[model samples]
Target: MTSRALDELPSRNPTGAFRATDRADPYWGGMFATGISDGWVSASQHRRATPEQKRWSGVPASFVTDPADALAQMRTNRHRPSILGALGAVASWRTITREQLAAITGSAVMARTYPKSLSAPFSAGLLAHGHVSAGMNRLAPARDRMSMWAVGDQIDAYARYRKSLTFAEHVAVTGGQGWDAEHRFDRHNVLTTELALRVAEYCDVATVLGEKQMALPALLAAAGIEAAQADLGRKPDAGIVRRDGLVIAVETTASVGRGFRGKVAKWAQILQRHPTYELPLVVLVVDASTPSQATSAAAKNTTTAEIQAAIREAVRDYPGTALNRTADRIGMVPWPTWFPAPHEATAGFLDLTASFLARGHGRDEGWRQMRLLDPGEMPYREGTTAAGETIATNARLLAATPHWLRTGTVPRTDQYLVDQASASDIEVLSSPRVPDRMTGPGFTQSVAGRKWRHMIRLDRTHRESAA
Candidate 1:
């Protein structure tokens, strides 16, 4: 208790209350975190505003008074009923319709239209009437706009209707070809046009029978027109054949390679399974080519005639069963029989094939044909002529070739070596070419002249390698 002891005793701590510290309870801490003025007066004022005033006023009066405090209160009561809610309640009736809401929201608006004299239960009818009457005044272009909107709706309905058809029904409507559906060709303008016409007919029938029609006839007609444009020249060759509650159409195209042959083989197998249905596949080879001296010049040195003869001979040896039974059942028609002259043999063949597949016959009936072939100049060069110009010549050669050969045919002839006439000039033939005494030429030249020369050389080389 001496003077020394008093000096040593710690002075009363005065800064303890001002020391930085964290609160254990966040709720109470948050309450203390805000400024007293912002926490109390500003927050309370915002909570007191009328809903109508808040709704009508762009910037709320509460926020205008104390922005910071009002903001805090607004954040806290974001989900709660406020002046905006009250205003909405007062204007609820006005916003009931989609158009009314759109007007307020400044959104895209949709409305109905009808004849000027027509009346209906909804305000939509009144709007329609007003639109029609206001040609030069307030509602000018209203009917045109309405028609456009109606077209959009019609397209949507047609899509929905197409989607709603049963698989069998879809096949029947698309002329029974699976490729049409697989490739979406059935949705072409031609097909759509046909469907639209059918839909229009249905509407007519509905009207006659006093039935309610959901889609407009005008819309269907438009779709039909589009379909017609898209399916130009292309047509279904096979007719619809119904069996076991299923409808299928025969489809055919000139055999190109193993891929097409495989398709044919598969069809043949399927026909075996459903013999009662008859073969629905057909093959047509059309010649669409112009005889050109340039083409003759290009092919002059080539053994095109010999090759064609060999191919014809090979096809003649193929089993008759290889031909699609459906072709025979449906009646095979030559390309020239169905198409007019001046047609490329190849194009005419393909067209006839497609037509046969679409109509199941060679004769071009009234049914429209849709052309899916690319509309450009042909690229193949037969002789000196462009392939397009010589399509008829090449097509005839192709048609004479057997399906197996066409599908399996691979060019074994080395074009580069063939381009050079003299065997001595060909470097690739040095080791493989063997001289022939009878031909009075080198082995390579003599061997090259033989039938299936490339295949023979290839086989010989393989044999030598094995030994």
Candidate 2:
């Protein structure tokens, strides 16, 4: 086979199915096709000790050894985006099943030719399959079917690809405890990663920082402050940063059970000191109700009033000013549990976020009332019917428009808004030249506006203090 053809192998294979080119070939023993490694040692098992070219028998001579290099080489390949999505998901979720990874990345076929594959030796060992120990359960099946996983050390090359060693550094900072929970599946972290992935479809994946990536101590060190100044309390589940210096901290919750107050208390701590971290807005993403939360009328399944009351109770002993600041700077939005988000769900959250942003900027009347409509193109909005039940899932953001104010309406698909903003000189908010549009003194004198202004003023104070 030609060298170029070997490299294109991954793109040719179908998602979730890896196979050899010719069944008659001696090396083509239907190994990968049946999900058996055939006792082949993975590159990760080698720990970079052996020469990959020699070790990876039957692998393409041109297949990259570094995961970053592997992804870089696949720039023109159809699966590059899916590969990136996989890497990003791993960075947050840490330990995910192969099925989940396939769903998140939208591809399972990483290897094309017999023994030559992007999922193994060619990619600097981006992922590893390991024992899913069901401790002391002798009755457990002989094999763990969901074996594929991405560990912090295994995927470091992707961090190198992003040219941000900080991503890898924090993984070490936590002693990689996040991945240590091998036996139990952390639905919360997995769900959070899913949310981040969904949000990333709209913005730069690099800009969507997961909580594990935003370790407080590491952040303080990067900002030139002593790590000791900050306690490793609760941090945002994810952070979305705009080029215009707007940072939205996201906190997600799936349960409102007995421990709900404790979670709120932790959140209050972060919100109370948000200015120190330069986090101006904290968005609470309430996932669909669990059985317990749904049945409990008092818990109220993630309503704004319920969360606000919890926040008030958490900081009741604090000064009135602090209480007000905490309440004003925080906003609660329902995370669309509906299959594809309802048009109103998307519009409501965006308008709320925009309204918060429009507080200080006078010319942002357009932004305050900004809205996003589905245009009937969203595949998941209408949902699917199966087993005589209609199911609505969650909404995923498609394109990011940092300059939505100037653009009028933002499109919810890929490349349209991002490319339009970059290719044209349409006074984009992403550029520093549009500072006045981002910062000024003119908003409605409504009580809500005044409250937002108050929150911004305090945010400014905290940022200045940190500086």
Candidate 3:
């Protein structure tokens, strides 16, 4: 592979870190500003203040003050706990020094934790009302390390919280759950909207490269106006109209999985009817990681290379034959494939979104569909036959391993059965005579069913039997 220096490639701003200048009030902000003070006071009082708190409330009063001196004094004091407690008491007093307050606020803003804290009240309010949805509330930890939040789990929590609170109470707490929910949805929408705008913004460039025709500069001018409008929270009026007379529909999503698969299939059908215009459909996958990497030149180049490769492959292997045909009909040619060195694929979605938005279609709905794509049917329940067989084979191999022999291992106990059984009844067998865990057929078969339950039972049972 020919390696290029990081500085060699043309640098484009991959991070859509452009702050939207439109100053319309954010729903969450309004919700928080109105509700946080009261909620904070209530939550604070509920946790009764102690004598130590009283003492800590007023001493070394400012956060900006040199705490080093106070810290040293505490350390030197024979009664360190008493001194420290007194300092804390002084600090906790509601009359925080202006300097201390400023320091605390500045730190909170930098950490992004301040927003989270402020949102708690609003979140409480939403829980009071019943407007939150189940899926939104079920945010769980992400299976992939790349994601920050278990979006499903967070959604679930938010939903549960909303269910318990009234709208007014929610507003009192933070703006309520509805506001928070809207914020989440709106962020996703804005991202998708930006993607469409990006596509529209770059239409002329694509037209030049793909069609080998000079598109009117006016198209560029229109795209710029739309981009500005999108930044202002105004949805731009744009649609995909191909030369072949087909009006391409746009969908925005935070996730792209099974839900989108159906949408894509439907779009394919629609494109079939408009044989004149090749359906020009675009999918903009918005990634939040681009800005993080874009700050460093080396990281940026590596990211760019990976993005280019992925996009090339995606376009080349685009599943829709109709879409490919449309690209050909429009005299569009794919851009030259020049991969940047030290490729990283995480930013592919961002790069693609920027490229498309720069072309001209800036206004569209953003949709988030979360699911993993499996080439074959998922091996859950009815689909488990083959997977079960594989597990069984592996389990037998594991049974013959020395670990199983030494441990006296048993395999394949169902979860429901284990759940019904007493903890003492379960046993784990670890015998030298048994094969390695992976080699045993029973071990593999157990894994096919309730693997954890089976293991736990086997372990407990073995220890009991040995005793």
Most accurate candidate by lDDT: 2
Candidate 3 lDDT at 264 equals 37
**Candidate 3: tens digits of C-alpha lDDT, residues 198-287:** 232222111101000112222223224222231232111123332222222334332334544444343333323233222122222222
TM-score, cand. 2 vs. native: 0.42
CA-RMSD of model 2: 19.0
* The candidate that achieves the highest TM-score relative to the unseen native structure: 2
Which residue window of length 10 is worst by lDDT in model 1? 205-214
Q: CA lDDT of each candidate?
A: 0.22, 0.35, 0.25
Candidate 2 minimal-lDDT segment of 10 residues: 387-396
Error of 1 at 99 (Å): 41
* lDDT for 41 (candidate 2): 31
Per-residue alpha-carbon lDDT of candidate 1 for residues 105-194, written as tens digits (9 for 90 to 100): 122222223221111111111010111111122233433421100011111222333343322222212212211111111112112121
Give TM per candidate: 0.20, 0.42, 0.23
